[model samples]
Target: MAAGGGSASDPLFPPRAFSPQGRACLALGSPDGRVRAWDTQSGRLRHEYVPSAHLSATCTCLAWATGRPTKEGPQRKKRKSEAAESVEECDLLAIGTTVGSILLYSIVKGELQSKLTGGHDSKVNCVRWHQDNGCLYSCSEDKHIVEWGSQTCKVKCKWKGDSGGVSCLCVSPDGKMLLSAGRTIKLWDLETKEVYRQFTGHSTAVSSLMFITERPSSESQPFDGITGLYFLSGAVHDRLLSVWQVRSERKEKSAVISFTLTEAPIYVDLAVSENKEEPVKLAVVCRDGQLHIFEYILNGHCKKTITSTSIVQIATSGKDDGSVPTPIPILAVAFCSDKQSLLLVYGNTLQPVIERVSLKTSEPHICLVRDIQKNLTLKMKTPILKVKTPVVKSETKVLVPGIPGHSASVKSGSSGTPVSEGKRKPGDKEISIEEQLGAMDIDSMKAVRRGGLPQTDSFAVLLVQGLESNDKNILNKVFNTRKEKLIKNTVARLPVYSIVPLLHELTTRLQGHPFSALLMVRWLKAVFVLHASYLSTLPDLVPQLGTLYQLMENRVKSLQKLSRLHGKLYLLITQISASETRQDVTDVNQTAKLVYEEESSDEESEDEMMERDSDDNWEEEEEREEQDVSADKEINGDSDPDPGEESEEEEE
Candidate 1:
């Protein structure tokens, strides 16, 4: 019931729920520990239970219970006064508080009926009532689950299930089995006063639990004695809902099925669909201000397969134009009495309201092709024919560069050959590769050398030629295609006079091919090292170095921004991971891994902070010394021995 973590817009008070008897009224809790019941149809307040200032505490959980009849008698007509008294006796609301006390308030009287205290030592996280037995079960941060008799307001049974404190509890309809979840999930047998079953596989603390029973055809009838023992457990941190089947015998393996959700769910409610085929529907109120409804079919073996899902976007604080909208987290969700609508409670501490949403939508129907005919055949009735058409001669006009004033017209045949050449005889000579290479010019030779160099000397030859050549296209091609492992050695082979053009080429291409920017940076460092003495005092290189400096400044700024964004995403992912499956101390046999958790509420002592500062300063000094040594090596033109390839295949 922690609702996990949220921003300022998230509701601060406890979550709400619809009444179990009729669900006509929705119960909402306030920050001041008051309970308000609102009519689901009219959206009006029906009852408000306000406590005294001394007994006031933030409401943490709410549960509704109808008072059981003291005795059974034959049905007979009653006067108006007797019927009104009966209604007042039946409606009761139980509110759990941060002080670990439970307040039972009569809805008809709009006042507290009884206060049950000294049951839990810590904050109560959940409270559930068993209508059949008139017993209330409550779990708290003190790691204990207490069952109190409603009439006596005293603890009937007390037991501990988890060491990390229980956050949620669910009572079986028959009051035989109890479900408790916190760091782990455990099932208890209320009658035997012992553990019934212990379920595993949830990597996070369970937030809510509900037994999925087969709803009867008539709403007036009670659940067919829990026709199915399947139940759902939701974990907010991991955004997962797992369905577990409780086996009647201890030896049978209980199957666990899980469904992943897009956002963390604060509350989940199940509704029985009117359609017989799709008998069950699930409603989930998520932290992103959206309502998700899942309609599924439950098989005989206790397996549920989702047939369809609908997502309703709830308007919180957004514009119609759809900009970046602020999310107002939903606090709770429940199905109305008719099961044709849903009620949602959302908003911040200042002003929270309940809204009703219709459940009806266009039902999807399958198109079935039922008719089938054997021996079906299709025959062509018309004969096909081939036709020959006359060919059209196309003329192309070419502008001759040598004769600028005159254009030449050329006619081509259907076979795509020039009409002037006519048809070539089979005996005519064909061109050879040797003739083509021999007739090539200087520019043609450069094009062949780009991709035609032998594997052995391709990188070395290209690097030297690219550096010496004035054309940037050749240099860029060489830089982009050269093997990364040979960069240091190949740059070392460049002549001292080619350093100026190499710097210019690297700087120019840095902006054009951003993917290769890091490779270019490495090349620049290598060039500066190889020709440090020859190029350091040359004033001709100053303008190029200034441009390179500016480019590097921009690159550094972009990387810094990316690093900050990555840190924020890492923080959120780690928080979720910690909440899901974290331990106070790892076992000795466990493998070492990175575990991220929130810092404690207590601030660091002055001595500890000072020590941390000193350590950081020492690390900074060591890094500076390392950088200085590397710079000295570069100046002395030292080459790394057997440097690994950096995968420079990325080219744009």
Candidate 2:
């Protein structure tokens, strides 16, 4: 989907909620009052629930109840029955709406269990579950933060200090302090219900605030030295993001980590890694539909900025460490205005592109490594029968244009007979012209292409085939080949989608041909080798590989249970060959096409066509109408002067 684009004045404000499981995101719609749950990993909507309990009022905020274990005690007969009636172990979702009401819904059974009213005089802006205490806290524009218990909706405590309405509210990690920002920030003691501190840094109304804990100390000691808990807040008028740290010095306590903004940040979200080694990263959603991720250091330095388009909300979850948090942080989720949601989990890795370049004679070769882990696993369970591993003939010839009289032979290895290397015999039909050209002028081919000449190399085409056997020896042999480097190089330069075209081309090239296990094995081995090499260059690719590896492992188990040894082997080989071949071809074609098109397009200029197309037809028509109307007015004025005006002029 295309990312959303608009001026800052027309900013979209969709209600967003974080899942209690931290595995998904919920996008709440206004007026229509529908809540849609989206899977974080896939960015797809999992389910939509519109509780009958919240029919008219729009849901403003949502919070998931953190299931805390109950205290241990002896089970009495009456108590057990009462417990069953009063408490049900289910996922509870608390939703605050526009009509000054709070609705608690049971998600497991998909039903609204309870409704509470009269807590807030105005619309509830935000709601959060307190981790330390089992109660829920909610703040509204009425300048009050009300606490609610399990059955009653009565306000346990009301924090009212700000002159303007409260725009945002958050509870500290320890749950001892509650922070609210409106025109100013007010810190309230959760236990005592007293205003403990007033933060007067922000010049304008504060939009959002979050509490973050730093990475744990290295020594096997508690985080006593880290008494200061940091808070990130953003302002609407100034578009500035400020970081404040609360620390105790001697007997007195103060808030630090103060900063100002260079640009106006509308929506701000903060995430501190739990890993302790990674730094705290803040994802800011700006009014301009731009998302910026900043790495915060202890000395108040902004280390790096990662920007994206049309990001509405940003969240992070993971180990509290000071490092570059992974794409799948321990916990991270971002909501986009474009109907899609992003979830950052614990183990997401980036995919790598592979490029194939010949090392023999300085020729640029490119191929994409296709991940066939899925297909391979399926084959492992249903191997093809009577399939022998085909011998890979290293005699494969590559044709290179622009470089004359250069020949290179790719050698293939098999268990039985090996073809002797020698000069090509006269009138040999098996050796194609393209192959001869590739073998003869590989270096010149690379040089000419590099020199902006048209490419005529056909060896760049990728061929994928499936193996019919699951022999470890075959797999080892296929992966342990010279083409391994080529495959690796190609895959590193291509995306997953580009590999599809290459696979289609290969299937067409080898029509009606019997499946060869050896060839398939060779291809699979080359692909695996390439992926392994690319993994080193792209650490983000690990998550993708991990997913494939898991699938392969599952297939192996299924094959063992089904007792389809040969079928499984065949399936594995075929899938591997097809995947690798498709990916390689797609990568080469895309790269070459892009390079070729860019070079070729500059030769011609279409100034006349551009001029003709640039004419504003709508404006021209309007101009013609205006000219005609002005001429009519001029003709009318000349044809007849006003009698009253003429008489007045004569009298003067």
Candidate 3:
């Protein structure tokens, strides 16, 4: 399912909700070189493109930065005098891809205007355009937030810190304070680019942040001392919705109060009502199935101290159990206020569903009966709430290109133009969109997803969708996802599908990434294990064992080449050492003998050295004979020494 709130003007799919600017539409980036645009009202494909065809990278994030048209080179754009008045320009869609590149596509022209690369070393998280002219901000998991000049397509400045990778960021209404939401919320002065205040209330990583105007219109009433700089932030886990009051003059942020809902919030968006009676409210969808609406109320000197008290206002149909809250998570939410207090919510169902719940009479109650108002009336037309997790459903679309208004003048290269920088023969054929679609595995293209991971990560969701899908083009999308993920875990989770198709895909999808060999080996091992235990029982699969043999053979050949190179490197290193030391002998015993010979030469000739080492043998013999003769003279004292010993001594 798609996550993140769209412009206030647009609602979720079947996009009936509208703003004066234009009808709401959605731009979705997928793995198969397509950026799809869908009409919000009719839930139909509007525009699609394959800007970076050779990149073959999955889309990570998407943003619309409304500003003056980016200046394409003289060849791409028309002169001001020749401009057509019939066409209206829209905001540029900054499609952040998995390869750390951004595509600036003109939604109006339905063509690529510019492309950016190498600004971030990792996948782009969020790309937001400051209301300021031509200024945009992009953040990545690489811990980099780069400000870009949309017109020049160049990085203007970079901001980084120890607080860690940026999860989300929101610009204050005044455009002075840039609040970054991560493990902690940091307020940075946009001009100085210095972090002045760090909000530490959140103990874990925060998912998103948005600024809300607390005060009413100046024409309606005056909020003399009220702080206008307020923001709402939510976390990725252990979620709490914190409403912060920013006192820029005081250089501080005070957490007015936070509510710990039953589930961690997946997305948070704020909407203000034009109705004079209605206050500013927040719309949230959580991991656990639930839809929440909160109103920002200020009282008692703009209170700083917080409490754990619940500020819940669940809309139940009956009077008997109006207090209990249900955990039905909404897929998308829109707080519409042309003149009415309506909240539109979409659920995960077989077909598309949009449930509108009126909140005009819903006054929040803190403690049960102490603050109960007239009544809590809600029309629960559908029961879509799940107690445990977010509701997710699969979306399967065919690979047909140029859906309706979307035209495919596919472009490539760093500039997002049709210029060819890659090596190509003059007569080489440029693959048409049809051929590209034909090349993809058609069967695996059917996508399915079921959890929170898919909501945040474009790559994971797409691959998991393909893994569980029944389309032949599964390899095209799944390969991009599988390249980064663990092969073992993915193979274990994949539903029974044709392994032969996916294995053939590894040849193309596994290119341009590191550790391809390792991934292939792990994949082969998993396939073998699955085949022996389970897939082997199936009929035509018996002949498919050749796929496993081919994988193993390629692996063996690679290992052999690797070992051969290793031996060559070792031999070269050993030869260099031997040449420097002048030692030809490698045998341990030979080395020992050589050392001994050197020592023997230092002392004397070999024979003389041994005799010297033995020492005084003849002197000992002569001494023994003399002692024996003396003992014979003193016969009684030394009867042991005999005549034969004395004779032998004389002969010596």
Candidate 4:
């Protein structure tokens, strides 16, 4: 599985919501009217349900309905095993098509059960399942909605919708009220079959809408002592994201929280957490390939930051393939239940890559943790795709700019026109504005000091874009490997603020290995070299850097003192050696004597020890003097030894 479903097949429009099967399984409907089930955990294809009559109609909407309630009926109580079997059989799928049709398929039965047709004048845009009584509600471009029974697949009720079309819709968790978006968001009463309240703040058509149940921090209490839901909507033209704090019974009391995005928005999702301290999170993906995550407390004070970004660059050196990356639309983005990973889908032309990107965000420095889908095929969407296999002849090790999970063996299709490898058409080098990034934006990020650099996720994504192959596993190795020099060089490339998070990670690693924390010295050196200009301009960065410098200096000075002490100890030992000496006549006449004396042992004082050391020195000096005298006499006797020989000559 090189990537997700995106290859030659185009993605169904963003509004075709996925139905989550058993924990991680997802059911998706394609424009070709194909309803396939996939396991999100392993990226494996599961099932392809054969519908009765929607094979050619474009799939526009999907909804999953479970037949069994929380407590099973009397027939399910025959045995414990029957209760378990009943739950699996209750799951059903409803798919809406562009030709104004709805098809219902039973999962356990493995067959298309029923079909409803000709309810609208135009294409069906949205379909939702009402949990109670197996009722399904659907809306279409004909400005009408029809509620049908899941059993008979017959219309139960009908309501008028927006004048133009129903762009999107969702049923409440309780399945009583309906939320729909088109020109404006309308909340409808299912029982009364009339629009109960209309929320209007958009200057353009609303393209996306969702009703998310607000999870209170303390389950025992309600939000501000009131049970509620949150209504989120995004407009296509103005690119405005609006979130409403909706109370359970008060549509008039709803509060509007809105924001403008950098690019036209594609999709938005709410991420819930179990931890009370971690605020409720929201993620919004734009058509320009930017993902922003916003966290807010219950008080509505929001802290928003850009988490993931997409940038493209052309290869310029011999090691590079000279291939450029083009920014494409992000179809959808969602956070897994763990809140530490992001699964995203984006494939505009050639490369429709679905990536499960790991996140490291606990520390101040956010970085790419790892790539869950290691085998994902990375495609570069560009005019280069118009040729056969787009092979670069250079033996360069550098990675080409493209999608993440860089692939070395991604062969282009056989359908494109063939051309010489090194040749390009005229004006091929004229890069479009969307393909290139502005200089000012990159400069501002580089100049950050006190405020902080880009968030860790964005920085990590930037690092990935900088690489030729988008090989994120190298980042995994850089953090986990034991090689000292490699860690040193890699850490040098990270920004200065990254040290804050890296230090926290290394600190945890330091508990088991005492010496690993010393790597911070190298980190300090890198920060100095890379951010030297900011050191003076940014006054607040001084104190922390100075402390690290002092620590390194102290360690160096201690090593120097130890080195000098070793040299002095070596000289002292050399001065205390013994040599052989010749004896003389005066030495032969000398006599030896031994004497013993008793001394008091009342714990020797410092003074007495010093006195004894002085006495030993004096005795050693005297002994040396006597030995010198004997040596001198021996020398004189050797030179005067000829005196006996001279007397003998005179007598002769």
lDDT of 2 at 646: 79
Regions of candidate 1 where Cα sits further than 4 Å from its true position = 1-13, 53-56, 68-89, 215-227, 249-255, 272-277, 300-308, 316-331, 345-355, 360-652
Q: Write the per-residue lDDT of candidate 2 for residues 273-304, one digit (tens) a residue.
A: 66555655555545543344555455433433
Candidate 3: tens digits of C-alpha lDDT, residues 1-652: 1125322111221111122133255554444446666555565556777765524455655666554544556575666654532122456777776556787887778899888876887766666667766577777778878888887888889878445777666666666767777667788888989987788777776666777665655566764322555667776675577777766466455567675676777655556554435655666666654556666554313444332222333332334656563333355555544423333344321122333445442644321112113343566678788555322222222233422211223333222323222343466656566654543433322332222222333533444556456443654444433453455556665555645555544544344354665555556666667655566654456465565556557767898899999999999999999797876656455344343346655866789867975677767888999998987768767554477988888899
Locate the minimum summed-lDDT window of 10 residues in model 3.
Answer: 8-17
lDDT of 1 by residue, 350-405 (tens): 33456776655443321111111224357879988976543434554422222212
**Candidate 4: pairs in clash:** 2-376, 2-377, 366-456, 399-468, 399-469, 400-468
> For residue 195, what is the lDDT in candidate 3?
82
Clashing pairs in 1: 203-580, 204-580
Clash count per candidate: 2, 92, 22, 6
Off by over 4 Å in 2: 1-11, 42-44, 51-56, 68-90, 219-226, 250-267, 274-277, 300-652
Greater TM-score among 2 and 4 belongs to 4
TM-score of each: 0.48, 0.41, 0.47, 0.46
Candidate 4 on 189-278: residue-level lDDT in tens? 778868767887776756666665656567677554224566677776656677665555655533356566677666666665444566
In angstroms, the error of model 1 at 601 is 99
Model 3, TM vs. native: 0.47
Q: Lowest lDDT 10-mer window, candidate 4?
A: 1-10
Model 3, runs deviating above 4 Å = 1-23, 28-34, 50-56, 67-89, 216-227, 248-254, 273-278, 300-329, 337-652
